[model samples]
Target: MNLLLNLILQEKQRIDYMLERYQEELAELPKGTIAEKKVNGKTYFYLKYRDGRKVVSQYVSKRNLEDLQKKLEKRKHIEAMIQSLEEEKRIAVKVLEG
Candidate 1:
């Protein structure tokens, strides 16, 4: 019971962090993967993502790749945190039940 309670608190904290980031820090970030293609010895970048069932691509300049990468990494981190919180919640519930 003690362990479960602690786990619950930890999960709550993480969820709060995720929400705060999503609302303030990363609110304007578009969802996509940074994809690169090379043509005849030159490299070009694009932000690739899915729209329903179709794969859409948005062009990105070389100068913007670094910023895009940072946003992508931050988005991934937030997603991982949300997943972790969900798992923790499930485990805590099971522990309390059994």
Candidate 2:
């Protein structure tokens, strides 16, 4: 039982570490126009235009950049949690079998 518990704990820790790494990658995404907008306050962030038509770069705003950063952080945290849980499960299984 003690071995099982220890395995679960170690697995959880490993998962958490992987998740943190994933989040870090997300946070490091290159800065660019992720979206666009039009006159009249209408947003058009998904579509990209090369010439003609007014298009606002979504990543151009400081607020958007900040929001992205926050999102990245939040995602990273969640991922870490998920990894930890998965590792725990794996370790539990191994211990139970052995």
How high is each candidate's TM-score? 0.68, 0.38
Could you give the C-alpha RMSD of every candidate to the true structure, in order shown?
Answer: 3.7, 10.2
- Tens digits of per-residue lDDT, candidate 2, 28-89, equal 64332345457588643432324455653333454465576565456556666767667666
lDDT of 1: 0.77
lDDT of 1 by residue, 37-95 (tens): 99999999999999999999999998888998988998888677767766766665665
Tell me the deviation in Å of residue 81 in model 2. 1.3
Clashes in each model (backbone N, CA, C under 3 Å)? 0, 2
Superposed model 1: Cα runs more than 4 Å off: 1-27, 95-98
Pairs with steric clashes in candidate 1: none
Model 2: runs farther than 4 Å from truth? Answer: 1-60
Query: Which one is best on TM-score?
Result: 1
True lDDT of residue 1, candidate 1: 70
